[model samples]
Target: MRPMRLLGLKTFRHGVHPPESKDETSGLPIRQFPFAPLLIVPLVQHMGAPSIPVVEEGQEVQRGQRIARPDGFMSVSMHAPASGLVRRVALAPSISGRMVPAVYLEPFPGSTQEIEDGTPCPLEATPEEIIAAIQDAGVVGLGGAAFPTHVKLKIPEGKFVDTLIINGVECEPFLTTDHRVMLEESRDIFTGIRYLLKVTGAENVIIAVEANKADAAEHLRETFPSDLNGSVEVLQVKYPQGAEKMLFSALLGREVPSRGLPLDIHALCCNVATTAQVGQLLPRGRGIQERVITVTGPAVKRKGNYRIPIGTPLRFLLEHVGVADDVNRVFLGGPMMGAAAPSLEISITKGTSGVTAFTDTAAERTHSPVYPCIRCGYCVDACPIFLDPALLGKLAATEQFSTMTDEHHLMDCFECGSCSFVCPSHIPLVQRFRAAKAAVRKSKAGAA
Candidate 1:
């Protein structure tokens, strides 16, 4: 209707502002990180079913080869990151610490960048073909979640998606990969949107960028020539604003039901980097080989955005990037909501957007020794989900899984880390609640 009267800067009600370490490379252009001698690709990069292994250890595979096939509708295929021989198809350490199945490839020295089977397709492909092409490309959400884009675009039978909300809000501190991609690959981002709109039958396409990245917003607004058939809206800068529900709330002023997705609210949000890759893959018919990752933290020597390959070992990435020799912790994503790695020896996955090397000092403020809650209600004020994280934290502390979900609405929590970040008593609210949720889910599964 009435152009919605420029909401100015829209955002959710609550969130905490952690240090925005994005300055190191916020303005830097996207550059290809040099191919490591060995690439460690994972089998379950997407959210659902894991891919089925197609290549065996020591299998001589060429560049653009299919290393694994989609396990089901929920899964996407895995491809060779480079022209190289498969070194091993075994369990490898992931950034999360646990061993996950991986395809190790030692790149052929001076491997050709040329694809062996690049059948260029015209952009005028039908919706079904475009969806199939996306699946063939093995593209997943490059923004942290790693959800299969093909699946996301598949609007359920009678359901209609009214808007395609492309996420350009790199709200996570220390991650500027999306910002650089927006500035550098605006064309690719648009290309991906054209196909996404066609496939999803979405009449509206809105690119959502945060107000903090004003330079990136200005660059895209200037470059896109709004004369094109799309909408770009700059959102209010807020922590967790990049999250699906928060961004949807900021743009549309709607809240996705607890434990529900944006699709439930007639919306679809895709990361700018993922869409850019969709642009690259829809035509070339290739799989995800590598992606942009922001490497930063107090311990790092050269902190900036890096275009790292899938399955690149964290140890190698950190060492190459020049982190301080003695590091206390390494986080796989941003300081908030990211999983801390047990060690730096884990391999990067499709969801690995930033490898944050937090030294003793950098990791200090975000956490503090837990103390008895004074019923301060600070967490209540800080929670974007409106759930009582303080109560959830209490339940988790006492191993009360049922109470956390049934009474406290633990599932509603996105684990945005705001509760943990804002707690004066230094409570690890998010981590404990996550464990409680997992236990409840397991118990429910057993009951079923």
Candidate 2:
């Protein structure tokens, strides 16, 4: 392990320190959320082709039954969150504000919610076999990326991974789902680590946690398996510390090349919650039906972490949790890096990590006046990727999308929001960069 720095904690170079705002719910334990009357299971939850529906309208599906099968290697299967009647298969609102194919289900009121078991993948299974089982289980990066976990485990030909970095750094403020997971599900995490080690062929592992979650770090350390070849490392508290690139850099003192992946540095980083789910589900022969979510904020009356079923409508969630009447805005994740919900009609998906609601009073406070860039270089200092957000913002204002990507390494930003958060001018640098990157992608696709 790399030598510790200031205060005996390892950390990356550039990042902001936003108000954590996690106290309201971080102490709370995870609770199973009541099933919604109508669950809208989006087939396109992960980052790939949408899954194809296997059941038609009016078909009865038991809890954990496969409702949709993966379209291709890039996609993942979907399961019923509860035993219910398939109301319809149609386009439904997703958190992205797009209407995608979804399976609407009316859960049976008094049916036993038993999960269907599939073939269990033992530790001795071949790497290829284990990866296939992961895909079958519909496991994805639970750290809000929603990228298929099975695909990530498949190291490209001719490349090798030496280290597996388990990310427990819940850097995004107000999201304690990971913290709770580490405290409550250490066994599943260790079991998952064994599978991950076999899949990646990593010689050793490192469970990275931030200073803020010392309790979780300690808990994992105490329960850590003696047979495993890794240890837990506490990192300095910093925004975006949970990012794969940042975590690897802090732990191994290695920098992933711009526009590159962890595998480029012979390392693999997986979210702690995602790892635990892999351990919890793979042995049970079950697919992902629900995930833990941190639901909290000023406008929420009963804020806490919830084991929420995938496809639970945001409207229903907020209603059940008791939101204030004057709640002005709600974000699917934390304030930093999370997108604002365009409509409450949009349902939760695999990537939904936290539901943060804000009151009108808080919204008004946050909607501060924007001013011209003062060239203070605060964004430059805050950006974790070492990009000049000041210049990027200037380019974005002039609609120079191509220039931004071609000349400034715009695609490497990852939309961490550190630049926007630290900008005294309130320039919305991250938002502009997101639009610029999208424009660049569209232009490239059109040219192709």
lDDT of all predictions = 0.81, 0.92
Can you give the TM-score per candidate against the true fold?
A: 0.95, 0.98
Superposed by TM-score, candidate 2 places the C-alpha of residue 105 at a distance from the truth, in angstroms, of 0.7
> Among these predicted structures, which one has the highest TM-score?
2
lDDT of 1 by residue, 1-448 (tens): 1112235666778787877878877876766777777888878787888788899877777778888998778888888878888888888776555677888888888766665555555579888788877877788888898888899888888788888889999899888989988988888888888888888888888888988788878878787745456677887777888988777777787778877777888999999999999887767777778889888888989888888888787878887889886677888898886788987567888898888887887667755667888788988888987888878787788898876777777888877888887888888788887788788889999999
Error of 1 at 286 (Å): 1.5
lDDT of 1 at 62: 76
Judged by lDDT against the true structure, how good is candidate 2? 0.92
Deviation of model 1 at 91, angstroms: 1.2
RMSD of model 1, in Å?
2.3
